[model samples]
Target: MKEKLYTLIIICFTMLLTASCGADHYMKKGEKYLALGEYYDAAAEFKTAYNKTSPKDKDKRGERAKKLAGCYDRINSTQKAIAAYRNTIRYNKADIETHLSFARVLMKNGSYKEAAKEFQLVLDSLPDNELAKTGLLSAQTAQAEKEAGSRYIVKKMDVFNSRRADYSPMLFGDEYDQLYFTSTRNEAEGDELSGITGTKAGDIFVSQKDDKGKWGKPEAIVSGLNTEFDEGACCFTPDQSQMYLTQCTTDPNYPRYATIVTSNRSDAAWGKASALEITRDTLSSYAHPAVSPDGQWLYFTSDMPGGKGGYDIWRVRLTSNGLGGVENLGEPVNTPGNEMFPTFRPNGDLYFSSDGHKGLGGLDIYIAKVDKRTKKFVLEHPGYPLNSYGDDFGMTFEGPHNRGYFSSNRGDGRGWDHIYSFEKPEVIQTVKGWVYEMDGYELPDALVYMIGSDGTNLKLNVKGDGSFTQVISPNVDYMMLATCKGFLNHKEELRVKPVTESEEYVLQFPLASIRVPVLIDNIFYDFDKYSLRPESTKALDELIKLLNENPNVTIELSAHCDYKGSAEYNKTLSQKRAEAVVNYLIEHGIAKDRLSPVGYGKEKPKTIRKKLTEKYPWLKEGDVLTEEFIKKLDKDKQEICNQLNRRTEFIVLRITYGMFDENGNLKNPPKAKEQDNGGSEDDGFVIEM
Candidate 1:
């Protein structure tokens, strides 16, 4: 019996050894496939190994997870890649590589906040990881900036051509017209040798919109400028008389060079191309030329030996004679990653494409507005949607249109690029003016609203500029209203009908000081705290400025609350809040005797709730207020009746002098005090309670 048992154990041991050997063999094969960039096949092998291996083998599980994550990333399964990396981390908590990999996938998925957390974890685990540290800092900065309301809204133009690889958009002089780019669906001028398999040879194509507002079919400019080799990344001078295009020599013998070639517009057609004698070398390649609006400067990308990375944008003076010496754009603009496709707008804004900069993926288009006086550029990313986790390049603006054109291989499209025209928002007659008390100082954060003749109400917050502009449909009359807490609202009727194509209409507002019987809204305070919240300070400051401007205007500070607590207690709380505002004004150098505090607790209901019996004469008493009834009421009325109706307000008691000029026209008043409260003429109004 003992011999028989021993035989069974030996057979079992042999079977176990065979299974282990098979799993190890498949894992090694999977690694080899992964190294060869055969990710699909690698995934299959890895799956086989994973299925055969025991879960107890932590080291093997970690290796399998890493391989699977790599394969998933290659296949563009970002969620799955993230999951695999997380699994690897779970199996081996100390793996900084897995954490970094996870963070990258998170960033690609737009989970920046979470990605930043993972990056931070990697830094904590491996302090010496320079790449991870840089990525973490970038992620953190982006997350913070986004939270701070610094965001770019990109609208994708639906216009596309299914047959072509349209890309590299360049704007011209006209606001609605653009020139953009492609290398597919068009024939080459000379020999049509395909650079990449299955597509026609690259050639620069031009499409124009006629006066009738219709985009004509794109046609390859038949000028001798286009060669059999790749030709693209074209930019036109402001006058549209000259063009700079990238000319690449694909012949293997001269495979390493691309030159910027220029052509003149003669007899309404581009002439023969002449290569600029800038950099002449066998090893260097130059492409993607961008000419400034004034035609005084030209920027192009090159992979020359002295570059900081794969390709860097180099600029040269386009003098009266010809092209001059080249200079690198340097540092923040050029990184260790590939940067190309530089273009400049009429406003001297530099727009370019970069893959080296930390971005969603592929190449992202970045803008650097040139400070002409300082001779410096400030680099910034064109935020999401305008940019995606795909190649977005060649942005062009037509004139100063809010809407422009750019090229992208994003959204629901074939894997090729397409030219899209961005619609610059209609040029509305922006009524840019400031709000001020009878005093000459500007009012900041004043809530400004424009009620159009068509009853369209558009609201805008007055910026520190003390100015507000809201884009509205032009050729209409608008009633502009400005309001701030503790100040009487001001109104002006403007008939802004722009007869020209574009114009600016300015309207100034001089608000009357709140004296006797004025209502103040939006007096917010902290939860369970009598102290004013930061937002409340904004409203209260406005009141202080109004008082300081009109020193003779005495006011009464009032507080109110909805029916929530005992009426007596609510009244006391409200009165305290009102007194707090009065004290704040007094502390800010306003006469303490100029303000009076009062409280109204559930006594004045803004929204009168009609009992069901009153609405339907036969209804019974004691019926509760239904949600439908509440919603039927105006939002402001409902808010004024909610339980959270805690507020502070001001009412002008007396104005020593009436606010208007002798002709009844509003006159700018003088400053009451010269105290420097760190308050500028542009400081917005503040009311805190």
Candidate 2:
């Protein structure tokens, strides 16, 4: 019996030891949770440990302070976190982690200069600490940037958590008074599951600002277009008559992927949803459609083949019928990580969310320029308050106000999803243009189209003045086309796209008319030859008409060669060519200057060609040719290279200007002026032959 009692004592001792170890384990876990930013559970565990600790254990006080400070920081109580951190620093001067944490909290609170000093203290003690160095650099950078002009000041407003809401906010209307966003708020009338979120499905919601500039309560968009499944990321046609939204099936087993769906607004009521055939694909998912203000191109995100990474942004030409084939956005805009939720503001600036590039965390919002010349994207990240260590995405500007909406999952109040407003940087601007007729008149009711080289089409309609304008996006080639009934369509090829403020481009078209004679300005020929040059036929056909019109009028034929060979040889060659032209004209029954033939070789020069081979000190003369040089040139060059030097020309030297009587006999003859020699007084004509 005594042995059994001893055994019972040992068992109780082991049980007490195990309970103590369990409590310590939980305390350690609480500390780890604080580090990982999971504050709610950490607070509970730390509270239990603090209550269990003995009153004399002074270390417990410091532990409680540190844990509570972390909880406050996670909840965005910056002031309280600062005080707690200060207390911990005072009590535990040797804890480097506490000092670093305090500095980080200070930085978050906008006390950047103070944060820099704290980081410097840590770095001085541990010179090779990478985190300390990084913290110091960031603090210094923030301090410096504060001195620069604040082009954008990001302000985090109230955290929105309307019962399971998922945000993808966008701005609509010229004044930005209305905001449209995608959400899965339980209040949605349909109350369906969103397959993408694995929760209550998404529906379009709208919020409006009151006269006082305060946002009104969000209300579901009660249109025929709102579906039970996901519907988000919408863009308006230039006329605002049609709305395009990205729709994804709620069922994962569904074969069809995300697609661009359209709805027509007629008489203020939305019509049934219709998928854009050109943009939809069974094999690929397409979402986040952004239409330019003019509706020329449709920019969106896709996971289609050939993309750089997950869901790279792409574009397609928008036609009256639908969207064109998709083209990938390459380079800096797309990375090996997921890029989604692209939006184009009225001013041509692009905002999107990306996990492909370096960012604060998860999916951070990024801005980039569309380089029209290089056909590539260049990305820029908004630091600090504009971005946080959470998924920040789906941004849209509110016109020139510099205010915008974006979604984030930062701070501890709400779980991982909500919409927030921030101020946009002012470095970006918008481009605008118009469409007109060839007669310089506007074409009302005409459609203006702009297509990115990558196949994104933005569409717009012509106003009463036949004018159309759209914010020009950066980094994409624009193929602009203007179309209207009863007018010949016109197209302008813009190789490099611009991101400048309000660029104006005019496109004109001529009304279709009967085909008329148009001059051909381009032609080429061989040297001193009577035969038709390869390109000469392109122009000769137009000339044939004048011959057919005035058969009675005669024209003089002349040919002159540039100086390059012997004068006698050149003269003879020119004369033969001139005579050959005269013979051909007579055969065609065209009275040349009543057909006079002349050849002024070597005597008359069209252009003075300097003798570069000649000696002249301090002068480096370039090659020059006069009529005199034609005869001195080598046979090969004289016959070929001198093609520009030798060519056929004509002058209307005479015409039978008389009217015929009723009996077909000339009743009166017009007086004629005597023709001068085929030479200008400045340069006497001499037929070498």
Candidate 3:
């Protein structure tokens, strides 16, 4: 029994020794790879070591889990990182950093509420930890940010993306048709997968839009510029003669750090590239180059010493000889976490991505502009859709247009970045004018003459529908005159209001006829009263203004009543109504001689117009709405037709009213008389002058 016990103890000791040896080997490899910034390789090794180590060895297993979680986080494997972090906290529940990291991954996964619980846990121990507080705030507001969306219309550019990651779009060339971007597709020149990202290295690729405005299949740039190492996030000078790109040269023994390089265009293609030495800080990593529109500043991201914390955006003077004036952007722009992928608009607005800012988790895109008052950079989150709970960065605009392309890794479970297009539709101001004869259909032959304060003079021909549309400048006042043969001219003054969204201003030109009576719209009277209702003031005021505008024109005001009332009663009633309108017009700065009052009573019924027929489809156009015709219809239709007939209208008596002598200004048409009472202008409407 003693001999058997000794043999069993020796076997168990050997098994323990073998397990320790296997786990230690993986642990050492993981540590080495992690030091070299090879996150993917480190994750694989650490995961293996965590599985191989004895479950009873909590210390070793917890450390291995923590390292594995860090590696997964670096590569943006959110689920894996979350699981690894959970395992780490389970083994070593007291590690605040592990809980903090787990919360951050949860935020990236859009589990903001859950992430807040973990951040609160971190704050329980380190009460003043800024990172935990910021993370907690971010988790709380992420969903709210999603509800407040941006004006930008974003769509995934599947044509620009591939199965692997593609990002950092740059629009250049004279036409802005040549699109350059970074892609980690199979076409990349680098053969081996990147130990840093777990995918092949990203390379610069170009896709040209054809004459038809369609993007072609992307092809890798075959210039001497591309190398076996990582190359991406490129930008060009204003002239696009020089291209600056981020390059990462690999050395298995040492860590790989990104550096900026420049390549000059020769005969259309970039020639050999050379390292762009910004600062002598060889230990720092620099990437994501963006050149200003004026080519005076070269903005880039770096992790150099003296940085606020993680990678911060820095700009340098793009001098004739290399670059200088390295500035850290500071305060509101930079934070303890990463701020990268700085871009610029044509209007000098700075756009960048930030993981440290209060945002919707991961890296959210923000617009930064210098406040004219404070002169300090003010950062603004563009809101959700323009941003998401994923790594959204890299934006490029099409010249002065608000539309452009950007990058995001929102929905891809594989954690691969993809290209997306965004556009804020431009607001256009237009003046739409409709010309027609009064009490008639549209006048398709009408001509509109327009003169603007901004030296805009145009003669627009009306379309078949008697409508003309013209793009109007904001803050410009325009005078438009509508004219048709044998019809009196109508004038309108329009002021284009300043607006930030698309709008169309409508102007109606109802020309007075030389041959027919014109109905004044919106005039109303109550019961049997001759006095105009309050609602009739708008239409009456318009008529008064029209007479004042066309001072040389004279009109005979007439009122008609429905067929329900007796002819004599309607005659007296309409006569009083017409006289009341004339009195109101004369009271409000109109020449009394320009008006003549008459009552048609029920002698001529209302003729249905095309507009009326559209409203009441039972009625036919040009049909007179007599008592017989109205009685055939339903009670609703009869009442509507009767309401149409009870209206005040006018006929152009003469277009040369006050044009002759100034004193004979036709002050009162009722008191004017140079003709017989039997004639056209003297049909009992004139009292002797």
Candidate 4:
């Protein structure tokens, strides 16, 4: 029995030695593959070593799990990575970055609440970790936004997608009919799979929209653009005559570096591509090139020395002399994380993707608008449908509108990118205007009171430049009044008809001042009578239209006279003249409550302010007209001064337009104006002034 026990012990010792040897061999092999960035083979070997090795050594087991998780993450095996991260934490609970990584993968898997829990765990230990805090906020925000639903209509473009990764869509070609993108499908031109992604290297693919506006099957671009390595992420000049793309050239003994390349289209085929020649730094990577709308700047993503993060968006002047100095986009645009895929709208808004900045999760698209006042970039994330928990980047606009195609890995659990067509619902029709002095500069303190027939009543203040933009619903008629404290209110009428496309209407309010008595040009009364002449119909009709446009306003129609008539007689004549004008307005659909006739019989005469005095150098400011003043002037000048006094003017009395309450609700919601006609009469109204 003693001899049998000894033999059994020797056999058990040999078996343990064999198991230890096998685990060590696999572990070293996995480490070698990991160093080569071959994540697939590295993961397989790591898994074998992990299963064979004893868990008695907690430190080694935890390290192995961590390496396996990293390998899974690089290979796009998110679930396996998450499981491995969890196992690592179970053994080494103090690993803060592992917790953060675990949370990110959880968020990417659409388990936002779970990810938030993990992120909170990291914050519990570090307390002031910005990355962990950002991750927590991102997870919580993503949960809320996803539950709130989406404002955009997003559809996965299956016709342009493949089972493998397909992304970075660009709309180009003569009619914008051809859609070009990067794909890692099995048929890619590359014979070797990428060690970094563990898939076939990226290649350019194009899909053409047929005459019926339907996308056809995608095919490799192949026209000297694709190589055996990686090529994709392209942008074109506004004219689509040139293409700037990213190409990764793999060297056998050296690491692959992403570089920008340029290709020209000739007779519908792309010419030979040439290196973009940014720098000779072998350690740096450059990609994602975009051209400015004016073609004066070339913007691209790079990891050069001066970058604020691992990767940043940079721009260089594209001049006749050659590429100018490189400028980093900096700060809010670039964080301590990667920022890629920079593009532009026709209006010069910069859109890019960043993982360093606070986002929903992973990579999120953000827009940076140059604040005209601060001269700095203001970042904004167009929320919800455009962004998801998964990586969302590589955006391209269809023309200038918000409707376009972007790349996202949202529903794909394997982190495979696919193209999605997104369209914002018909935006509210916008009406913008600027208010200024009639013959002078902008009135910065101007207030724009808007009253829409569709129950829209709001007060908007002008920007520093006296400009105001307000949104209005479709098929609504809006009446806006631009008023200043010392100026007569200006009225504008707009009727927005429902259309399939978004519309922007611009209106200008050139307001006259109350400091001087503005003449009502083209108003002719009968000889020595209050009755309006036939020629005065045009002026009275315009006054009626103004009243209708400013439905909530009340105006005092003041009738004046020249210095010729006696004071008492002129008073009675002017009173009758003002009354007749009010009666005509009431007859032409002007509410009686909106009209107040005042007779300023020669009592109030015209005065020339600094502006008028400059034009009429013979006159000076604070000079009021009387018989003595008019007689002192020349014949031509006397006629001008007298004509200025013999005028009818409507002074804005109240601009509140009883239509709205202080809270913006319509006081007496009138019917949706007769076809958004600014509460006025129909198109065919005969004005008998």
Candidate 5:
């Protein structure tokens, strides 16, 4: 009986040891996940450890609670984080980071007074703690802002969002009627839950706006892009002919790293996807692909080596020769925090979200505009209602306006991002233009100069059928000039009406040939006095604009006289008239070297073979107008012939202005300038198992 009793005691002791060891295993696993930034799993494991801790071991229980609170905070569960932190403080009240973290959660939950007290407690111990000081200030500011009411009315997009997470929206189609986004809903193709989010692997989903202007239910994006593996986060080429999507494949032996893949769109359906050859590293994650507006660069977020930290934005050139080496966007853009979901406005400005930058809290959306002087990005936060103490990102503009849809986890404690529509209520406008030769052929290499009455100047170079687009502000007057080698400069002007509605204007620039003598019409001298007529101001101004537009071109401005004038006298008078025009141009901004005056003095006769001959059948080609010829015509016809013979014209003297190299490429394309605000840094993937 004694032997049996001893054996039973031994069995009970073995069972107790097993339970204790299991708790230790949970604690260790939780620590590993916390280090990996997998807060969801870490919280689960830490909660188990907390429940397993002996009631007498208050220190061990407090440690477990503290770790659980951190995980909750990282995952955006403010209430749960607050509860866990309170439990931790009940035992360990002097932990500085814990107190600061508790204050942060309180601030996020809108408990400003409570948060300030907690932050003060930390400051008492660590008086120089910047995070604590900042937390206190942020909490006070948030409380005040909340009371003042928000200008933006943020409502969750119910029709497009699910109980699960949906984010990274991209607008496509010319009308922007199709919206593509990433989701981890239960209906996703993958059956397994992700270790990161504890949800089904992400899949691409699309929502369409109906004719009634209402968003319909979102459906899984077709085109076989979503397989049994994880696939999400996509961007389309400007033409919408192709897509680059992020895909994460699973392996039992390793952590999944996201890779970017391309798929062609044919007849409104997507073709099979093929992985892009961005890098050979299998361990680094590449996601959040954004194609540059010019279609020459593919930008993505990666956790590769050489990154500032976490995930950094990198871009690779997509050339005809294939993908070029990756470049990292360094410094202010990337910190020791994750920067993702980069998108561009129709203009060249870049918008992205980052947690590294100082903000209210979490990830805040920022606009990065190129600084002209520094040749770097100047970052700006939109402030207040457009941002919150939540993960706000994945912004997409509807055309060129300040209103659009974005993803955010504002009110949800579960960190479930949902689509939200935002509007700035300000008027926005855009201008698009096409440059073509006089013969109707597209000028692919045309240079376009853009200037706004509001002190905006930019140069745009076209590639395809000479076309360019620009964003404009409301109530501004804009002028654009298009020029190409062997083609006369063409000018266009537009005034954007100041209205609350968004507007787009299409302008056409039909450039004439410089190789052919292009006439400067309506350029009449004042009664042979060699002074320009008041009626000629429009034509002369256009000439000045052309000279300014084509900085590299030198033009010989030739003046001609009617055959009735004395040959020697007319030559001297025409020379004076040509020189007058050149002087006027110099007084305005044209360089003197670019303009040269010459006198033709009836040396070049008018050729009226086609259009003029069709109107006046009596006129013939290569006809030189003289006193005898004018006398043969009627009074009306005689005056018309004389007027046609006496005009100003310009022909190409040299097409190789300093504007282009010997190979015909632009030598001085528009340099990066800052209007106001705003690497191939890649990483090697490490197996994080």
Candidate 6:
């Protein structure tokens, strides 16, 4: 609660007051409270000083106005900030930063065009300034962002909200039905208001769902947890046994610095709280603790030294005995601007709030996903509604689901943070596999063994029609193998890509039969020609890969023809076309000994299978496409039968071809031998498109 509004406001107050010691009594007292980061006390005292200052004293009046504006901005008093900054700019336009500061307030007030003009004015002098550039971009974006909506549907959760601030919601338990948050309502244990916020110090509160999933009334914890000091922003361990929260203790003489505290949770109630000593850097502030999903690291925000700027997210290796090395999550996670309130999804995707990156104003939430290649976190702005000109932070997800709760101050004119529930209706990631026999149909008895680099090993059984759907984590590489008796295992590898919307990855497992020939679809040839078509490259490449996967197997590559062609003509054309496929394979890397070319012209007919029958309802299962059967059909049906008969296929000649030699010993495991190409790439004649 007490952060930028406090820590930053105090520094501004200290720099502004160089006036005489004999200045008004109100001014002197206000300066004292301001230096101590007491925002509420400082604002009250400064108002008295401002009213009493004479209009004739432009020099002194402008200084007081600037001081008041800085405080108002921190306290999130939009109208007050605007009025005060306008007054100060009227007298102190000499300060370009003042214009930039005023423009930011205009942005928060939704005066985008006005904000753009102010930013352009700042840029008129400091053309290359980063802040001014960002301000102009944000102003333009806010205008468009107004009409843009993301997939997320957010609803204000007023069930546990109070007139005062209720923020930092935490979801726990098996069903994520238990809700915990922090509030500064009158119901808080403290009788006195905080000097920083002018409200009762925040205390941890809880709300639970009934059998019907409706949340009951929320109650503040009055036991050993709540004290006169402010406490909020809590996260639980992976097991939900221990809670880490942020607490701010008051010292009348020293500036308030936030620290992280831990509390043990028993059957129902939380027990005594203790300070979690992250480091001995007492001069710095440590707050907003978020434990990593694997429970190996503790992530938090700090103004501690070695940070990129205002506040940066940092973490320490969590160990049984004590904390290990600490490191700041450097840019792009950390920027020259503030980044705080780090949280995580069950899949380990990092979520944090920041004003540092390009976003829709104050502390927009961003997701950081590790790149599979570089393995470094990259930022993604989730877009508007989930973000606004007002501050939005503190996100809590309900397990792996895209639905969850976060805290925002978007609609609250007083800038009081409240809880809101958010759900991404269709942002799911899954892998669907169709396990079946190659050139045949679905293998209902097949089972797939899924293996992942993340140590995921699962036995996924295919459905009655040989399909299996499994939820997959983003950025994981999975290897799946379909297994069934009398069939060679068909393996598929997939690396799921990360996206902001729902995505389904489809894979086909056509397990080759141990006895029958497997037809390679999509391999076509020109009319009455032997050369392979360019469109046939993909299917040919897949066949090459299949042969390499089942290395020991040697296959007979054959081509067939319909009864219309003379036997002599069909045999010669089919043999040459079959050799074209063999030469292409050999030229690409397959050995000649592993492939045998044959032309079964009009001799072998086609047999309709379940999949083919489904596609052609007129064709019955087990029906044979013989010459007489096709002669009796309609022209269209007869053509379909001829196309089915004219095909390319491969049959396994031996599974142990290279397994043993004549001496019954492993043939010194032959290295892949490069085959000779009948023609060179430069030797081919170019074909016009």
TM-score of each: 0.46, 0.44, 0.63, 0.62, 0.64, 0.62
Q: What do the candidate models score in CA lDDT, each in turn?
A: 0.67, 0.62, 0.86, 0.81, 0.79, 0.84
Best-to-worst lDDT order? 3, 6, 4, 5, 1, 2
> Per-residue CA lDDT of candidate 3, range 182-301, in tens?
888999986799888888888899999999999999999998888888899999876668999999998989987899999999898998789988998889999999998657789999
TM-score of 3: 0.63
> Model 4, residue 105: displacement in angstroms?
1.9
> Worst lDDT window (10 residues) for model 1?
680-689
Tens digits of per-residue lDDT, candidate 2, 339-376, equal: 88887765566778875555444466777766778845
Q: Positional deviation of 366 in candidate 1, in angstroms?
A: 2.6
lDDT of 1 by residue, 527-584 (tens): 6456666676776776776676566677778887766678898787777888888887
Model 1 global lDDT (CA atoms, 0 to 1) = 0.67
Q: What is the lDDT of candidate 3?
A: 0.86
Candidate no. 4 TM-score: 0.62
Cα RMSD of all models vs. native, in order, equals 25.2, 24.2, 19.8, 18.4, 12.1, 17.5
The stretch of ten residues in a row with the least summed lDDT in candidate 6 is: 680-689
Per-residue error at 601 for model 4, in Å?
69
- On a 0 to 100 scale, what is the lDDT of residue 401 in model 1? 41
Better model by TM-score, 1 or 4? Answer: 4
* Residue 77 local lDDT, model 5: 79
Residue 321 lDDT, candidate 4, scale 0-100: 76
Pick by TM-score: which candidate is best? 5
